[model samples]
Target: MPIRIDRFENGPNDVLDLKAGTQPHIVLTFLATNNEQAFTQTEIHEATDIPRGSVGVVLSRLEDRGLVRHHGRYWAIGDDERLASYAAQQAASSASTTDDYYGESDE
Candidate 1:
Protein backbone atom coordinates (compact mmCIF):
# COMPACT_ATOMS: atom_id res chain seq x y z
CA MET A 1 0.00 0.00 0.00
CA PRO A 2 1.21 3.49 -0.82
CA ILE A 3 1.71 5.94 2.06
CA ARG A 4 -0.84 8.76 2.15
CA ILE A 5 1.50 11.72 2.11
CA ASP A 6 -1.38 14.17 1.73
CA ARG A 7 -3.09 12.85 4.84
CA PHE A 8 0.10 13.10 6.82
CA GLU A 9 0.66 16.66 5.68
CA ASN A 10 -2.89 17.71 6.51
CA GLY A 11 -2.92 16.31 10.01
CA PRO A 12 -1.84 18.51 12.90
CA ASN A 13 1.66 17.80 14.14
CA ASP A 14 1.44 19.76 17.39
CA VAL A 15 -0.14 16.90 19.28
CA LEU A 16 1.59 15.73 22.43
CA ASP A 17 4.47 13.43 21.49
CA LEU A 18 3.75 10.84 24.14
CA LYS A 19 3.70 7.26 22.85
CA ALA A 20 2.86 4.12 24.82
CA GLY A 21 5.89 2.49 26.55
CA THR A 22 8.18 5.49 26.05
CA GLN A 23 10.06 6.67 29.12
CA PRO A 24 8.10 9.93 29.22
CA HIS A 25 4.81 8.19 28.62
CA ILE A 26 5.50 5.62 31.30
CA VAL A 27 6.55 8.29 33.79
CA LEU A 28 3.65 10.60 32.98
CA THR A 29 1.07 7.84 33.19
CA PHE A 30 2.45 6.67 36.50
CA LEU A 31 2.34 10.18 37.97
CA ALA A 32 -1.05 10.92 36.47
CA THR A 33 -2.46 7.71 37.93
CA ASN A 34 -1.15 8.64 41.35
CA ASN A 35 -1.56 12.38 40.95
CA GLU A 36 -2.79 12.88 44.48
CA GLN A 37 0.71 12.31 45.80
CA ALA A 38 4.22 13.25 44.75
CA PHE A 39 7.17 10.88 44.62
CA THR A 40 10.93 11.16 44.57
CA GLN A 41 12.94 10.32 41.47
CA THR A 42 14.15 7.11 43.02
CA GLU A 43 10.58 6.07 43.75
CA ILE A 44 9.56 6.82 40.21
CA HIS A 45 12.50 4.83 38.87
CA GLU A 46 11.71 1.86 41.07
CA ALA A 47 8.03 1.91 40.24
CA THR A 48 8.47 2.41 36.50
CA ASP A 49 11.55 0.17 36.27
CA ILE A 50 13.35 2.84 34.25
CA PRO A 51 17.01 3.47 34.93
CA ARG A 52 17.47 5.91 37.81
CA GLY A 53 19.60 8.21 35.67
CA SER A 54 17.10 8.12 32.83
CA VAL A 55 14.24 8.85 35.20
CA GLY A 56 15.90 12.04 36.44
CA VAL A 57 16.66 13.13 32.89
CA VAL A 58 13.12 12.41 31.77
CA LEU A 59 11.70 14.31 34.71
CA SER A 60 13.92 17.28 33.96
CA ARG A 61 12.79 17.31 30.35
CA LEU A 62 9.16 17.01 31.34
CA GLU A 63 9.56 19.84 33.82
CA ASP A 64 11.14 22.01 31.18
CA ARG A 65 8.09 21.39 28.97
CA GLY A 66 5.72 22.21 31.85
CA LEU A 67 4.27 18.71 31.64
CA VAL A 68 5.36 17.89 35.19
CA ARG A 69 6.33 19.78 38.31
CA HIS A 70 8.68 19.20 41.21
CA HIS A 71 9.40 20.62 44.64
CA GLY A 72 12.47 19.61 46.57
CA ARG A 73 12.79 15.88 45.83
CA TYR A 74 9.15 15.26 45.00
CA TRP A 75 7.52 15.23 41.56
CA ALA A 76 3.89 15.28 40.46
CA ILE A 77 1.81 15.75 37.36
CA GLY A 78 1.68 19.26 36.01
CA ASP A 79 -1.36 21.51 35.68
CA ASP A 80 -0.91 22.11 31.98
CA GLU A 81 -4.28 22.25 30.17
CA ARG A 82 -2.98 19.90 27.52
CA LEU A 83 -2.51 17.20 30.14
CA ALA A 84 -6.19 17.19 31.07
CA SER A 85 -7.20 16.85 27.46
CA TYR A 86 -4.61 14.16 26.89
CA ALA A 87 -5.85 12.23 29.90
CA ALA A 88 -9.42 12.48 28.70
CA GLN A 89 -8.42 11.32 25.25
CA GLN A 90 -6.55 8.38 26.75
CA ALA A 91 -9.54 7.41 28.89
CA ALA A 92 -11.90 7.60 25.94
CA SER A 93 -9.58 5.52 23.81
CA SER A 94 -9.31 2.91 26.55
CA ALA A 95 -13.09 2.80 26.89
CA SER A 96 -13.53 2.41 23.14
CA THR A 97 -11.02 -0.44 23.06
CA THR A 98 -12.69 -2.16 25.99
CA ASP A 99 -16.12 -1.81 24.41
CA ASP A 100 -14.85 -3.23 21.17
CA TYR A 101 -13.25 -6.15 22.94
CA TYR A 102 -16.15 -7.09 25.24
CA GLY A 103 -19.13 -5.53 23.43
CA GLU A 104 -21.00 -2.58 24.93
CA SER A 105 -23.79 -3.20 27.42
CA ASP A 106 -27.38 -2.05 26.78
CA GLU A 107 -27.85 -0.66 30.27
Candidate 2:
Protein backbone atom coordinates (compact mmCIF):
# COMPACT_ATOMS: atom_id res chain seq x y z
CA MET A 1 0.00 0.00 0.00
CA PRO A 2 1.28 3.47 -0.83
CA ILE A 3 1.48 6.10 1.83
CA ARG A 4 -0.82 9.03 1.43
CA ILE A 5 0.57 12.41 2.34
CA ASP A 6 -1.80 14.88 3.94
CA ARG A 7 -0.87 18.53 3.89
CA PHE A 8 -2.42 21.20 6.07
CA GLU A 9 -1.92 24.93 6.11
CA ASN A 10 -3.08 27.07 9.00
CA GLY A 11 -2.26 30.74 9.26
CA PRO A 12 1.08 30.54 7.48
CA ASN A 13 2.05 27.27 9.02
CA ASP A 14 2.25 24.27 6.68
CA VAL A 15 2.39 20.71 7.91
CA LEU A 16 2.69 17.46 6.02
CA ASP A 17 1.63 14.16 7.54
CA LEU A 18 2.47 10.78 6.06
CA LYS A 19 0.09 7.87 6.44
CA ALA A 20 2.31 5.15 7.86
CA GLY A 21 5.31 5.19 5.61
CA THR A 22 6.70 2.04 3.99
CA GLN A 23 7.72 0.84 7.47
CA PRO A 24 4.65 -1.06 8.63
CA HIS A 25 3.95 -2.45 5.20
CA ILE A 26 7.58 -3.37 4.77
CA VAL A 27 7.71 -5.13 8.12
CA LEU A 28 4.58 -7.09 7.31
CA THR A 29 5.93 -7.99 3.89
CA PHE A 30 9.19 -9.18 5.40
CA LEU A 31 7.45 -11.24 8.04
CA ALA A 32 5.15 -12.85 5.49
CA THR A 33 8.04 -13.56 3.15
CA ASN A 34 10.11 -15.11 5.94
CA ASN A 35 7.52 -17.69 6.95
CA GLU A 36 6.77 -16.13 10.34
CA GLN A 37 10.39 -16.07 11.41
CA ALA A 38 11.56 -13.41 13.81
CA PHE A 39 13.72 -10.72 12.26
CA THR A 40 16.34 -8.45 13.73
CA GLN A 41 16.62 -4.74 13.02
CA THR A 42 19.59 -5.37 10.76
CA GLU A 43 17.62 -7.95 8.83
CA ILE A 44 14.61 -5.67 8.52
CA HIS A 45 16.84 -2.86 7.32
CA GLU A 46 18.38 -5.10 4.69
CA ALA A 47 15.11 -6.64 3.57
CA THR A 48 12.94 -3.53 3.64
CA ASP A 49 15.49 -0.85 2.63
CA ILE A 50 14.67 0.96 5.88
CA PRO A 51 17.54 2.62 7.71
CA ARG A 52 18.89 1.00 10.87
CA GLY A 53 18.13 4.03 13.02
CA SER A 54 14.61 4.36 11.68
CA VAL A 55 13.77 0.68 12.08
CA GLY A 56 13.67 0.99 15.86
CA VAL A 57 11.37 4.00 15.68
CA VAL A 58 9.10 2.25 13.23
CA LEU A 59 9.10 -0.96 15.26
CA SER A 60 8.36 0.97 18.41
CA ARG A 61 5.47 2.66 16.69
CA LEU A 62 4.18 -0.65 15.41
CA GLU A 63 4.44 -2.10 18.90
CA ASP A 64 2.54 0.80 20.34
CA ARG A 65 -0.06 0.31 17.64
CA GLY A 66 -0.27 -3.42 18.45
CA LEU A 67 1.19 -4.59 15.15
CA VAL A 68 4.48 -6.11 16.19
CA ARG A 69 6.33 -7.15 19.33
CA HIS A 70 9.96 -7.41 20.34
CA HIS A 71 11.62 -10.48 21.80
CA GLY A 72 15.20 -9.90 22.79
CA ARG A 73 16.92 -8.40 19.71
CA TYR A 74 14.40 -9.77 17.26
CA TRP A 75 10.95 -8.60 16.26
CA ALA A 76 7.95 -10.75 15.42
CA ILE A 77 4.46 -10.15 14.25
CA GLY A 78 2.60 -9.75 17.53
CA ASP A 79 -0.30 -11.82 18.76
CA ASP A 80 -2.23 -10.92 15.65
CA GLU A 81 -2.50 -14.29 13.99
CA ARG A 82 -5.46 -13.11 11.95
CA LEU A 83 -3.34 -10.50 10.23
CA ALA A 84 -0.67 -13.02 9.43
CA SER A 85 -3.28 -15.36 8.01
CA TYR A 86 -4.72 -12.57 5.92
CA ALA A 87 -1.33 -11.62 4.56
CA ALA A 88 -0.60 -15.22 3.67
CA GLN A 89 -3.94 -15.51 1.90
CA GLN A 90 -3.29 -12.34 -0.07
CA ALA A 91 0.16 -13.52 -1.06
CA ALA A 92 -1.19 -16.84 -2.18
CA SER A 93 -3.94 -15.20 -4.15
CA SER A 94 -1.49 -12.89 -5.87
CA ALA A 95 0.86 -15.71 -6.70
CA SER A 96 -1.99 -17.80 -8.07
CA THR A 97 -3.17 -14.94 -10.22
CA THR A 98 0.31 -14.41 -11.57
CA ASP A 99 0.67 -18.05 -12.38
CA ASP A 100 -2.67 -18.14 -14.12
CA TYR A 101 -1.85 -15.07 -16.17
CA TYR A 102 1.46 -16.55 -17.20
CA GLY A 103 0.02 -20.01 -17.94
CA GLU A 104 2.24 -21.62 -15.35
CA SER A 105 1.25 -24.29 -12.89
CA ASP A 106 3.01 -26.02 -10.04
CA GLU A 107 1.46 -29.27 -11.12
Candidate 3:
Protein backbone atom coordinates (compact mmCIF):
# COMPACT_ATOMS: atom_id res chain seq x y z
CA MET A 1 0.00 0.00 0.00
CA PRO A 2 2.24 2.75 -1.20
CA ILE A 3 1.13 6.35 -0.96
CA ARG A 4 -0.01 7.68 -4.32
CA ILE A 5 0.09 11.37 -5.10
CA ASP A 6 -3.26 12.16 -6.72
CA ARG A 7 -3.20 15.90 -7.13
CA PHE A 8 -0.12 15.78 -9.29
CA GLU A 9 -0.92 15.10 -12.89
CA ASN A 10 1.05 15.20 -16.13
CA GLY A 11 -0.16 18.61 -17.07
CA PRO A 12 1.28 22.05 -17.70
CA ASN A 13 1.55 22.97 -14.03
CA ASP A 14 2.39 19.58 -12.70
CA VAL A 15 5.35 20.55 -10.59
CA LEU A 16 5.75 17.00 -9.42
CA ASP A 17 6.65 15.96 -12.95
CA LEU A 18 8.70 19.04 -13.71
CA LYS A 19 12.44 19.12 -13.18
CA ALA A 20 12.39 20.88 -9.83
CA GLY A 21 15.97 20.01 -9.02
CA THR A 22 16.20 17.26 -6.41
CA GLN A 23 13.53 18.47 -4.00
CA PRO A 24 10.17 17.71 -5.52
CA HIS A 25 10.15 14.16 -4.26
CA ILE A 26 11.21 15.28 -0.84
CA VAL A 27 8.50 17.93 -0.66
CA LEU A 28 5.89 15.49 -1.88
CA THR A 29 6.90 12.86 0.63
CA PHE A 30 6.98 15.38 3.44
CA LEU A 31 3.56 16.74 2.56
CA ALA A 32 2.11 13.27 2.25
CA THR A 33 3.43 12.20 5.62
CA ASN A 34 2.98 15.34 7.68
CA ASN A 35 -0.08 17.00 6.15
CA GLU A 36 -1.48 17.35 9.65
CA GLN A 37 1.58 19.18 10.96
CA ALA A 38 2.84 22.65 10.24
CA PHE A 39 6.46 23.02 9.15
CA THR A 40 8.85 25.74 8.11
CA GLN A 41 11.21 25.94 5.15
CA THR A 42 14.20 25.35 7.40
CA GLU A 43 12.43 22.39 8.95
CA ILE A 44 11.67 20.96 5.52
CA HIS A 45 15.27 21.36 4.44
CA GLU A 46 16.52 19.65 7.57
CA ALA A 47 13.97 16.85 7.42
CA THR A 48 14.43 16.13 3.72
CA ASP A 49 17.39 15.49 1.44
CA ILE A 50 16.43 18.46 -0.75
CA PRO A 51 18.78 21.33 -1.39
CA ARG A 52 18.21 24.43 0.69
CA GLY A 53 17.93 26.77 -2.29
CA SER A 54 15.19 24.78 -3.95
CA VAL A 55 12.91 24.85 -0.91
CA GLY A 56 11.53 28.29 -1.65
CA VAL A 57 10.63 27.55 -5.25
CA VAL A 58 9.06 24.22 -4.41
CA LEU A 59 7.13 25.70 -1.54
CA SER A 60 6.01 28.53 -3.73
CA ARG A 61 4.59 26.20 -6.37
CA LEU A 62 2.79 24.18 -3.76
CA GLU A 63 1.48 27.33 -2.14
CA ASP A 64 0.33 28.87 -5.39
CA ARG A 65 -1.86 25.90 -6.14
CA GLY A 66 -3.59 26.17 -2.76
CA LEU A 67 -1.82 23.04 -1.61
CA VAL A 68 0.27 24.56 1.15
CA ARG A 69 0.22 27.69 3.28
CA HIS A 70 2.99 29.83 4.66
CA HIS A 71 1.85 31.43 7.86
CA GLY A 72 4.52 33.06 10.00
CA ARG A 73 7.19 30.37 10.06
CA TYR A 74 4.91 27.44 9.49
CA TRP A 75 3.93 25.86 6.17
CA ALA A 76 0.75 23.89 6.60
CA ILE A 77 -1.28 21.79 4.23
CA GLY A 78 -4.21 23.49 2.56
CA ASP A 79 -7.86 22.43 2.65
CA ASP A 80 -7.46 18.98 1.18
CA GLU A 81 -9.13 16.75 3.70
CA ARG A 82 -9.88 14.09 1.14
CA LEU A 83 -6.20 13.49 0.41
CA ALA A 84 -5.40 13.32 4.11
CA SER A 85 -8.21 10.89 4.79
CA TYR A 86 -7.17 8.75 1.83
CA ALA A 87 -3.63 8.54 3.10
CA ALA A 88 -4.79 7.59 6.57
CA GLN A 89 -7.05 4.88 5.17
CA GLN A 90 -4.25 3.52 3.00
CA ALA A 91 -1.94 3.39 6.01
CA ALA A 92 -4.53 1.59 8.10
CA SER A 93 -5.18 -0.90 5.33
CA SER A 94 -1.51 -1.60 4.96
CA ALA A 95 -1.16 -2.14 8.69
CA SER A 96 -4.07 -4.52 8.71
CA THR A 97 -2.62 -6.49 5.80
CA THR A 98 0.73 -6.76 7.52
CA ASP A 99 -0.85 -7.95 10.74
CA ASP A 100 -3.02 -10.49 8.99
CA TYR A 101 -0.20 -11.91 6.89
CA TYR A 102 2.37 -12.03 9.68
CA GLY A 103 0.03 -13.96 11.96
CA GLU A 104 0.59 -11.48 14.75
CA SER A 105 -3.07 -11.18 15.73
CA ASP A 106 -5.61 -13.85 16.69
CA GLU A 107 -8.48 -12.20 14.85
- Best-fitting candidate, scored by TM-score: 1
The better-scoring model by lDDT among 1 and 3 is 1
Which of the predicted structures, 1 or 2, would earn the higher TM-score when compared with the native? 1
Candidate 1: where are CA atoms >4 Å away? 1-17, 87-107
lDDT of each: 0.83, 0.70, 0.68
TM-score of each: 0.65, 0.64, 0.60
Q: Candidate 2 — worst ten consecutive residues by lDDT sum?
A: 9-18
Alpha-carbon lDDT of model 3: 0.68
Residue 12 of model 1: what lDDT?
A: 65
Off by over 4 Å in 2: 1-21, 97-101, 104-107
Compose the digit string of candidate 1's lDDT tens values, residues 1-107.
Answer: 56489967897664445788899999998887676789999999999999988998899878978989999999998988887766666566656776767776789
lDDT of 1: 0.83
TM-score (C-alpha) between model 2 and the true structure: 0.64
Q: What ranking of all candidate models by lDDT puts the best one first? A: 1, 2, 3
**Tens digit per residue, CA lDDT, model 3, 1-107:** 54346533433555454343356545755665676788888889898867789888888887777667778888865667765774476457556866756765667
